[model samples]
Target: MRRRLSFFACLGVAVERVMTDNGGCYRSREFNAALAAEGVRHIYTRPYSPWQNGKVERMNRTLALEWQYGRAWDSEAGKASTLPAFIEHYNWGRPHSACGGAAAHAAHRRRKQPFGTQQLVIHAFRKSSISM
Candidate 1:
């Protein structure tokens, strides 16, 4: 969670709040401390209520179907190696219905910043050795 927070910070995005299910990790003292240190509000969905976090749940489902179980991998390293490319394609190449048939980065660009600025940031991110 701290790493993700830092990544968003590097992207110049202020994360004011985070919503997650009532999972053990989210309830841990270390996680709460991290959120408190960052001054980010933590919200938990009602127990058994997946609808409260529908988008994340849907994404998890998609990831499971399309990536995790899509093919047989010879080793864990092989599977792990494909994640970054999958994420890149998912974010910048594939069209999403929720984004009005545009890629997620396109919708994010329209909503957040001009195309050139977003491209520059993404280019920098791609060039950097930062591993998520």
Candidate 2:
């Protein structure tokens, strides 16, 4: 997970914490050490607690509905071209059910906080790295 997170670093995003289920593999000494080395807090969700995993689950469902299976992409480049638009809509246009019906960016603005962790993840869809 630590090495995988380096990809986010390449996108000018700093990952501070990660929440995952209490899987045995994630609880291993090596995994803990890796997260510690990266200065990332490893947050383990409660066992059998689906609510704790809601945010990630919701994002996956949204991506599937809005991006993956929603349209036909003529080519890789075609998909790439359209992704940013969808991401823009997702962050700035659509009202999220979980954010009191506020668009994500609007909600973030109201709170005066940085972008949501999940929203920043749209950078992963880019074909090129963006330097900070």
Candidate 3:
């Protein structure tokens, strides 16, 4: 979380709040401390309510369907190696309805003031691996 916070800070993005489900990791003292140290407010979604965090849920589903399960990989490393490229394409190539049919990066580029008055929200989830 610290690393991610630093990354966004370097990009001139000020993280204001984070919203996550009732996950154990998110409830940990260390995680809460990190957010508190950074002056970021942490919010928790109602239990069993996925719709409260629909955007991230949709993103995770898209990632799984479009990249993770799109093809068969010979090895885990091979699949891992392709993630960055897929993320790059997802952000810069594919069109999104929220962006009014423009790619996320392109939409941000069109903005007169990028990151201005925008509150960055980080949603952390446990890492899961696919069993081959």
lDDT of 2 at 45: 76
Ranking by lDDT: 3, 1, 2
Local accuracy of candidate 2 as per-residue lDDT tens digits, 1-132:
755687668755788877776766668798789889999888877899958877655665687777866787677667666766886787679998868999876877788765434444322221122111
Candidate 1 positional error at 1, Å: 1.8
Superior candidate under lDDT, 2 versus 3: 3
- Superposed Cα deviation of residue 132, candidate 1 (Å): 17
RMSD values, in order shown = 7.3, 7.5, 2.1
Candidate 3 residue 7 C-alpha distance from true site, Å: 1.5
Lowest lDDT block of 10, candidate 2:
123-132
Lowest summed lDDT over 10 consecutive residues: which window, candidate 1? 120-129
Q: In candidate 2, how many Å is residue 16 off?
A: 5.5
> What is each predicted model's overall lDDT from 0 to 1?
0.71, 0.67, 0.79
Of the two candidates 1 and 2, the one with more favorable lDDT, higher being better, is 1
**What's the C-alpha lDDT at position 47 in model 3?**
99
Relative to the true structure, candidate 1 reaches a TM of 0.77
> Tens digit of lDDT per residue, candidate 3, span 26-126?
89999999999999899889999999999878778887898889998898889888977876787679998988999876777787567655554453447
**Candidate No. with top lDDT:** 3
Clashes of 1: 0
Model 2 pairs whose backbones collide: none
